[model samples]
Target: MPPATPDAALTSATASPQQAAPDAQGGVVLAPVAETPPKRPRAPARERTIGTKVAGQPAFVLHSYPYKETSLIIDLFTRDFGRVALIAKGAKRPHSQLRGVLQTFQPLSSSWVGKSELRTLTDAEWVGGMLPLEKTALLCGFYLNELLVKLLARDDAHPALFDHYVSTLNQLAHNEPATIVLRKFERALLKETGVAADLGRCTSTRAPVQADVTYVVDPERGPRPERASDPWPRVAGKTLLDMEREDYQDAATQSQSKQLMRFLVAHHLNGAPLNTRQILVDLSQL
Candidate 1:
């Protein structure tokens, strides 16, 4: 028989070496070899990392408040990073570069670095293509910023919603109907956060909604036939479908969708009041 390879011989047995007696002619006798333990591999060394750094990202200042004596705590809405709280060191100082650069409603290219929930702002510069929001549009911009600060969680990326927000701002700046703009933004926010339901379908029937039927939207579920005891807003099926298509030209669609969206937003907020909403409501605006 062919001899076992050296590896096979070593692996096939774990017994101690046995001493063999000399042959009749007294030839040199070979002893069985004991198995040796396999060596363990050495682990690779870990790299020393300090923190994360993001640069030249699209962003906007949602809100800011004075921090310490010369710094500011800023709530920033970023295209890729969502809502982030940043400490803008020396931002409140009269001659600080960031003092003039960190205005709200302006597009910015920003850089930040940190490992914690709140980050350090490294640099920011205005992108400067968008027209400034003025008059009621300025208030509306603040309202949008408020919604983002309240609804979105830190470090959650919502690139699509961010784009929609820019578009909404542009529309509002150009004097488009504020009602339509606010409704669209509210719907997008709810849908992006997984809080919105399909308005064209009935939750109970598993079928398309009838345009003439009156329904109440369940916050956790979708739309269902209205009950007399239900406390939710009653919306006509046509209004729901119109909102689904984003067509608010009809007066009834406009009025009913306003109430429906308000109810849905309030439900998702869990009784938390929106300050900007109250201000607009007091002014008889959206």
Candidate 2:
């Protein structure tokens, strides 16, 4: 079934990565600064497998909207189940426990049930500890949620991506730079979705990428060196190499990587615009 509302269509709420920097041309290069914090402990009450009834499955409320006069429909990203839609029954009441818990950005251990397309959120608890994002970091955090809602399919599991997400969120909560964090997450997202071309080797020649060449990442063909003012978005080979190492210290690399990613993402999205992306663009800080 389709979502009760468009993914995050009704979030009239305020919310909340990386060693990042402001893009000289208006973008962000968020890469990991330090190791990701430890993973949240698995909810002990969770069933051994992902089934109709989930108990304390580690999850995040990606986005939510009022479902009715007294309930809410939420899109959740679960550790095992990927993007799952759950109805937070009666969560709209001012006194409801779920009201405070079903919030974006914060981590939670959630319980839910139902074999249908949409499930029911039975329980949620805050997995507190990390600092909340402020100012720019908070917007970047919402941008992450937007990407997940748009790119990932429901019920598909990518444990690696999920772990990266947890790490990304933790980094966002801290003083780490933001550009590197977003870039790393964007790369991970593309990789998980199977659309990102490899950065390690040239696609056409299968030659290992060198640190000194200039290359353009072919969305279909992989990274190829720049040629005579190459048309496709361009980045230095060192930048690609640095990105492969998950590093974004070089200014040229940060600027170029941001452009390369935007082009590839736009191509893959087939002209479907990302609203958050546009907001970032308008604010000149993606």
Best by TM-score: 1
Q: State the lDDT of candidate 2 residue by residue for 1-286, as single tens digits.
A: 7765654654523212256777789898766456668997685543444555878788988899889899999999988889999999899899999888888888899988888888888899999876788877788889999889988999998789988998998898895777788899999999999988779899878999988887888787789877886789777788888888888998887888888888888887778888888877777676
> 131, model 1: CA deviation in Å?
1.0
Worst 10 residues of 1 by lDDT: 42-51
User: What's the TM for model 1?
Assistant: 0.84
Q: Tell me each candidate's RMSD, in Å, in order.
A: 7.8, 26.5
User: Candidate 1: where are CA atoms >4 Å away?
Assistant: 1-51
lDDT of each: 0.90, 0.84
Q: Distance (Å) between predicted and true CA of 16, model 2?
A: 70
